[model samples]
Target: MECLASLRTRVHPVVVSAQIASALYDTGLQMVVKERCSDNSTATEEDRQKAISNFYMTYTMLSSLLPFVPAYFLTRYGDRGFRKVPIGIPLLGYLISRTLLLLVILLELPIEVMFGGAVVYGLCGGYSSYWAGVMALESASSQKERRSLCIMGIELAYGIAGFVGSLSSGHIFQIHAIGNKNGVVLVAFCIFLYFLCIIYTFFILVIPGTSAGNVEHRQEGNVGILWNIVEYPRSCNIVIVLLFISAILYDIAVAGGMEMLMSFIMKEPLNWGADQVGYSNAAGFVIFFTSFFGVWLFSKFVADAAMIMIGMVSFAAGIYFMSFVTATYLFYLARSLTLFALIPMPTIRSLLSKQVQPSSYGKILISLQLSFTLASLIYSPIYTKVYQSTLSWFPGFVFLLSSIITVLAIIPISMVGWRMARQEGYVSIEGD
Candidate 1:
């Protein structure tokens, strides 16, 4: 605690400087409103406040949809093209669509039109990961060193991108506001700007890396949509049971904790605005990027299981501390620490790749996606209920539940290594 306090004393000034600059920009927007509209006697203060609140809610709902649909699309179609169109083109389409939607938020587009575009954006964003995942699986060697490094590099790059993306959002928004663009126009323009990045990614970043391999496409045969869950119970290796359960527990912990943090911890208790969510999220991404680099550096010394255990400990501690935080500094610290929990994800995914036969790689990835989707659906709604009902008491409940679940997961994950060793006859455990 003392060390954390000392770290905060050193770090808080930097965070404060950035946050203050952002707040000043928002303040400037408010000043624009004051200056442009003389007295504006027609619009009551309550009316203006109501519009702002509604816009914020719409944004949140749209953002949530962004990740889910895109992931599903990508999972289903990332490797294959539509009707012989180059797969890259459709992927480009998805990215462009998402860029437009994100731009909507950045440019401050009309809430109504953006609400529609957001749906498409969410779907494309989800799909991007599928392409990346397929590429990783195809390229990585089965050797532990090569696979670990490959997964670590991808995850580190992703975290760095996310961290940078967050910082960029604030600056873009500030620029738009300073130029006197309305919400709708500003957001549309922002989308245009990001779409350029997507185009570059597709043409420049993605093209060279992709190739038509001997990878077999899934049979579009008699496999029913729902039956895929139970029918392919063994689609993954026997160790999948452990991975499934662990993924569920970890995601549950994450979803529940985030609900507590955003809905209650920072906003309701601390009396902060929506923009604070963006800043805090950026800070978390920075920490997550740092932890991912740690995964890269320590890949040789760390077993995937050991890294997961460390992540769980950090997650539990972060959640517990978050539940009790009263100071603003503590909130930032808790969020930063919690991102350490995310560092183990790519490592776990790499382990999953190893457990299955090489022939079953695509199927296993699909199954993993299904498992996580089901877990998220089951967990998020329940967490939402708990949060809404208890209000201030919710964070503690969510954190405690996560801690207990992590404890339960320990034994199962331990058995995973043993199970893998029995199948492969060669133990890939760290220090072996």
Candidate 2:
């Protein structure tokens, strides 16, 4: 009875951790930028832009590159017996990183030291393993028919928590009670929250019995992980492959575009303060809720592939609008236009989940994560460099490029839709 109760009460720690981490990382990075660039009265605008760009690039590179191996092992081995290890390890990494940030602030250490923190975090599984664990747990626990809703619910929880945390983070950082040094109070709160997540994940959370054991018998063979990777694509249908590719492209475009947006808002025409940054981030989180609603509403009548196509169109339009953004109101307008933008990735994930066998969830998610990380490896440095080079002439060029990439994402999604229709034996009528 006690075990059943625990299982009933289980909620993924990633929800809270993602929220707190987003708030802390966003505000914390801003503080780092201010200290590195603006704090020196002698620093020129060019100096500040270069400093911020270099710091973010270094952090992105390290964070994305270091996690691949550990994350792969965690996801692969996790299916064997150690389910919680994937979630716990990343949470531990988060704790260490947040602690390091606090110490960096209180001890007046160099902002570059945060690179070490990123390394520690990445080595422990980072976002890839953490999120994959969350998805795997949800996929295992919920009925197949309800899995899509369950995943979307998780995203909604993550988004709402992020919205609340971001809304308050700016105020928390500005609190004068913690001395004149910025982000001390905010970092302290982050540390406390991370600590709570670690405790709850280690002690309280439970995986339900339904998905607890390795139901799919692996007795057929002990093919090594490398062989399994080589076999994965050959095993999957072309539709699944295209779906995976579409998901990867959308993620890369969104990530690269947002990275540029972060740096963009910090500079010239819109020199966003911490409060403005908080509000902007809050607005971004609002998309999660809006997207959830969009998915729920659209799922009633539209095919998943069609829904994804709509989302891609919305995102492309939003990015196009963002390219012309000069005022804060226009920024908000651009965000509003993308309210349905959050739909594609989750929908793509849902489509992919439906295509795979139950036992393959961990492997499939790991593949998706690897693709996302690989895309980051290519896009982050390129986007940062492009942003820096065009800082004086066309800062919005990245957004235009993002819009183009999103439009291109529509191709694979369209193919998936056509495949689905054919599989369903539905004949297309021209101008019907």
Candidate 3:
């Protein structure tokens, strides 16, 4: 009975709700864009590709710019006892922004109006703040030893929600409402889900009390934490810095590859429709399960840093294979090779959390997310243009580039593993 209560307390209802809403919104918007681009029968396939890609580039760029300051502020506030500040604000943003998409479908608004929606979303701190806040709560609730798995558990909920949502979203999107209005029904459902998420997060959610383990670490005078890593540990700062570098590099590679991939599947031989796109997205979410189990299984034998390398290798190999994929089955086969890919980032966050006091979890995690967003400002547009220019010669060039970059990211984490073993003698915290 006590264990059942504990399990119920750890469950995150809002995370699951928001992710389902997100999956629905993604499919709705993608189909809308496909319709808008195809409205002109005169446009070539490549022309349609460039148009869709351009829309996302501008939308993503807008979304990235306004989040840095707001996310930091929300996270900072959450750290200082306003535990709901980060999550609530972003949920509000999601509600409003998703509403805008609904209006776009129903009222026949220009797609560019989503630029305004993105702005509204960013002002409230976007995904960076929301995810960082959620992780902070998770960190507060668990010991350092099991933090990786605990965090992965939140990701598991998120992925399962995304998978279920994506699997159904395409079918829902085909439902026409109010005089043959396409996606109105789907976008309306998304808004309803977000509304529920906002209410759940702000009203019903209980922020877990800080764990005794986290309190002990904080009392050890590591309050300086990720700001400085620690005082006693030799080369701690170096390890932390390397972790940051590797995380940012890995994120860029993954982000760039995935962004171009949506466009890739929409063109030429693949030319994926709404259902296929949903299935593809569902396939991506399956990795979250495989990766959670991968961590569960692998952590018994290898260190955290080793698990990070294994994930990177998984992704790099999979993405390299993706470079030659020309068929739907081939794409799924490439995706299968990435079974362990989602392990790296959350595991990296778990390691970083171990370095910091609980008070700084939101700050440090938000900072890492913000850093990745900053890097996206540089890479996102470049990925768009590279895909455009290479359309005829090779559309998969970006995937190959991502594979190479993923390999480069492994170097820093490898260095951290060596530094810990040879010098700092940092024991892998597996609880007392």
What's model 1's TM-score?
0.66
Model 2 ranges with Cα > 4 A deviation: 1-9, 12-14, 177-179, 210-236, 426-432
lDDT of 1 by residue, 1-432 (tens): 866544332212222222333233232232222223224568654343334333434543554545554454554453342111222333444445444444444555443554554456445443224433443343233465567556655555555555554554444444445445533333444334344534433433322122443123332233334334544336244567787777667767776566445445323346443345446556666755667766765666866777776777777777777767667798887776665676555657777776654434444565665456556556665665564445544445766676677666666666775665454454354436
lDDT of 3: 0.88
Model 1, which residues run further than 4 Å from truth?
Answer: 1-115, 121-144, 176-190, 205-236, 357-359, 392-396, 421-432
lDDT of each: 0.50, 0.80, 0.88
Best-fitting candidate, measured by lDDT?
Answer: 3
Candidate 2 lDDT, 74-167, residue by residue in tens: 8877666456778789888988987888777778788888999999999999989988877876776677666666788888888888998888
Candidate 3 off by > 4 Å = 1-11, 210-234, 423-432
Q: List CA RMSD, all candidates.
A: 10.4, 4.1, 3.7
- Local error of candidate 1 at residue 230 (angstroms): 22
Best by TM-score: 3
Model 2 vs truth, CA RMSD: 4.1
